[model samples]
Target: MRDSFEHVYQLLTCYFVKVRLVDPDFVFDIQTTSCKDKRFTWYFWCFGHPTKTYKLLRPVVMNDETFLKGRYRGSLLTAIAIDPSNHIFPLAFLMKDSKTTESWT
Candidate 1:
């Protein structure tokens, strides 16, 4: 399963690069401990609107995490902010092998 995910990972890398080029505020990062290791961690964030329009949004923000029970067990952290119009906007996302203070922070 990990081998099969290689292709998808490559596609996502390309997509992320393109998105960053198109939207300067689109930020993403992939981190690894060893250069030869296949295991890595990543996060995504968008500041395009957040930097400019955050003041227009309500002060209410929510965050949550969902655990995955698959081969590569992990958790996805997501944050959403409520806009003045009562719309929920995804503020950021993070993928970690486990939930911890280090990962969540």
Candidate 2:
């Protein structure tokens, strides 16, 4: 069992090393915690231009659905326009079981 754990650990270490090699300018961190309960974290960001790059590239139409993972189950759909820098613009959120392009946008 110990050998198997070590083997997987080595594989994960190599994966992170590859990410670093490809994105030397940006920073990436992956954290796992189990103090009270297991939690996983990951974040990635790039060194970018001084000016806000999130200019609206074009008019956007989006439709997505989300649901509760656990208790108080409900579903919602969100439609949004995103900008050039990956920022949400012209955004709207709605809760529905079903929706359409005309109804959302």
Candidate 3:
């Protein structure tokens, strides 16, 4: 670990990636400590949510060329649906811009 923001970002990306981009209720802060002197001083912030985020994942039939942020950034041409279990499941999302099919896969 070289002590950078990307290190913390990567560690977070690898660990707490269960719910995608949405944050939980109690995850209130992010900090990094540097050894500037004999004492360890940490830099941090309050990133917690004041209100809870409730999402009702429903079964959706979609067809759109949307924008999605990947690891390298690219166009997200996708069709997704939420199962009855509230899981954000991915459906068929790969097609041309003009090709209109009933459903993605």
Model 2 Cα displacement at 72 (Å)? Answer: 1.3
Clashes of 1: 0
> Taking the tens digit of each residue's C-alpha lDDT, what string does model 1 give over 3-105?
5555665566677788888888787777655678756565465546566767777887799989867565777888889887778888887777666576656
Per-residue lDDT of candidate 2, residues 35-86 (tens digit)? 6743322222332221233343455577777863332233455556667776
Score residue 68 of candidate 1 by CA lDDT. 68
Which should have the higher TM-score, number 1 or number 2?
Answer: 1
Candidate 2 Cα misplacement greater than 4 A, ranges: 1-57, 96-105
**Reference-based lDDT, each prediction:** 0.71, 0.44, 0.38
Winning candidate number (lDDT): 1
Q: RMSD in Å for candidate 1, one decimal?
A: 3.1
Best model per TM-score: 1
Over 1-105, each residue of candidate 3 has an lDDT whose tens digit, in order, gives 345544544464244344334645323222223445322112112223322222333635555675434332323355555657766654443322222252222
Clash count of each predicted structure: 0, 0, 0
